[model samples]
Target: MSHDNKTAAYFGARDLPDVIDYVGEFGAELVTFLPFVYWLYRAGQLGDRKVSTYRGMRPLYFFLSDDQLIEKDEPRRFVGYQKRTDPSIWGFIPNPNELIATRNAYEAFPNYRKQFQSTRFSFDKPLLVVHNKFNREWNSDTPVNFFSIDQLEQMFSRLKGYYQIVYLRHGRSGSVDGYSPDHNSLIDFDETSVMQRHPEVIDFEQHHREYGGGVAINQYKNELYAACHHFISVQGGGAHQCALFSGSLLLILHKRGPEAVHAYSNGFYQYATNPAPVCMIAFNDRQLQDGLGAFTDASLCQGRVMLGANGSRIANDLAPSRVQRKGQPVFGTDRTPEPGDVGVHF
Candidate 1:
């Protein structure tokens, strides 16, 4: 969880380690799994980079030669994905047609793979500055994850209020009902969207959208990441960093829990170095009926914020321009971890 660990520092191209920690040196490589089924759709709409690298960190130099570039790269190599770097003792599980989705992701939209060249997108000119009030609720909410909102609430009530529930997010809009605007992804649900009776629930996402205006969702999320009790890395794109930096919990809910199905992600979740409060629960009833015991209970989801911060969710380190133009907060803060909330997940 040491974000500034010099043990894996980049010495330079000439001094690279033969098999150093690739994932640690550059965390964005985890998003390589963008499925092809939604390629052009994501590009045309959100203009989302295929990879999900954090804002300031430079990417690692991919040593892949032309020969190694496309030798069937695993989906987990992408920024949005977490990969299993080692061989799995568990036998393979099938993803059926989903393999086509992974293939299409690489072949159709290849910007993420371009990391061997450019560090990030470059603006030919200064970015166009437009200041206006932006608003949307639950637009960027991710529909899939380790547990349903109902499932999470149930678990929290049973667990003696393990953690509070504040939701972080990215671009969302009217298009995010059952599917995103272009239909590349399902709707990203607001953490409180499904909460009807939980008085302890705090939805900074909803308030931020209505009253806490900002230029972009990431700007708000940066603040949320800063302002939370614990930035639990749950089921979506916007919250990746909390798990990486602050060392919170990880809850991975998958429909197909087969160790082989999406093996790289399961491997990543299974082997993540971050301490406990992390759990991987596959809700595959089919797998369950077959004597598969790979499921965790809904009561194990403990990474939500119980109350909302009184102010903005924008992080302080925002570029000066973003601070001025976006109308977001200068910084966010994280409270000390409570007793049960702190640990490495075994």
Candidate 2:
């Protein structure tokens, strides 16, 4: 939690510590668990360089070696991906503390800042961010877009009531319903009876299916937090920071295997009795939304804003231009996390 002189800093690296103590340093607690499947896709995308570093575990000297010379060494493709970079811009070296502060500061901007209006916090509130690490099924070759009908149903049903939900679709839009241009919102993922059931949910697709849809979604949340409540997500890290800084309660929903259900549940929910009003919502149920109400109920009882001023700090420090560019490759293609890498396996 303390980054005295011993800590080394760099630019363009994503190897922040798994657990970040935000209380003393920033008054919030944020944790990150590596997503094994996501790492594999990222690694596989890097192709040949896949063997060098595991999920950005070690410092990526390649950026320093090339000095933004990514375009010159066009790497091979893994499922239509090629590693390339833009030299004009300097990549960021992420320090856990710096990133946290950066995220906090970023969210503090006027055009964007919110959540600090006194109405968001309760007397004894503990904002907790759970970092859920999940593993990938090595043999199962299912594209991110194509979730089994059962999986799709569970995913949607499990995320109810939570204010903000983020799903990282690593390209390849060939799933239960092929990635169609018009399909963007969660409702788009639902088909037949599922779609019919949520008739009132507006389909924010036409504008959301662009090149940097995810980035746009985050940006949108930055503005939306002024009025909304909490931001909950399965994907942790920066997204979680965004939520916390926005003055919304950070609900970390981790994905553990079915067998790990008891562990996951206890790990999160047990924190409810802590001095701070922080709560963890862990689940093995494919239907993640099942526990949405619990999170909302906890947030209400705690009377805490979902995000805070620190989130605004991050919004500023790590501006989109400073981090990885949209539609560009940051690492090699090897989506699976390597041996020493930390990740969640559910």
Q: What is the C-alpha RMSD of each candidate to the true structure, in Å?
A: 19.3, 15.8
TM accuracy, model 1: 0.34
lDDT of 2 by residue, 1-346 (tens): 2222222331112333222111111111122111111232344422222222112121211222232112211221112011111111111112222212222111112212332232321223233222222212323432221333454345445443333333333222333221111112222333446535544222223224543245343333233333334444453332334333433444343431121222122322222112222323333333234334344444343444332344333223322222221232212342432222323232
What's the count of clashing pairs in each model shown? 38, 72
The TM-scores, one per candidate, come to 0.34, 0.35
Residue 95, candidate 2: alpha-carbon lDDT: 20
Best by TM-score: 2
The Cα error of candidate 2 at residue 179, in Å, is 17
Per-residue C-alpha lDDT of model 1 across residues 9-40, encoded as one tens digit per residue: 32121222222222211222332222221232
As a whole number from 0 to 100, the lDDT of residue 328 in candidate 2 is: 26
Q: What is the C-alpha lDDT of each candidate?
A: 0.27, 0.28
Worst 10 residues of 2 by lDDT: 80-89
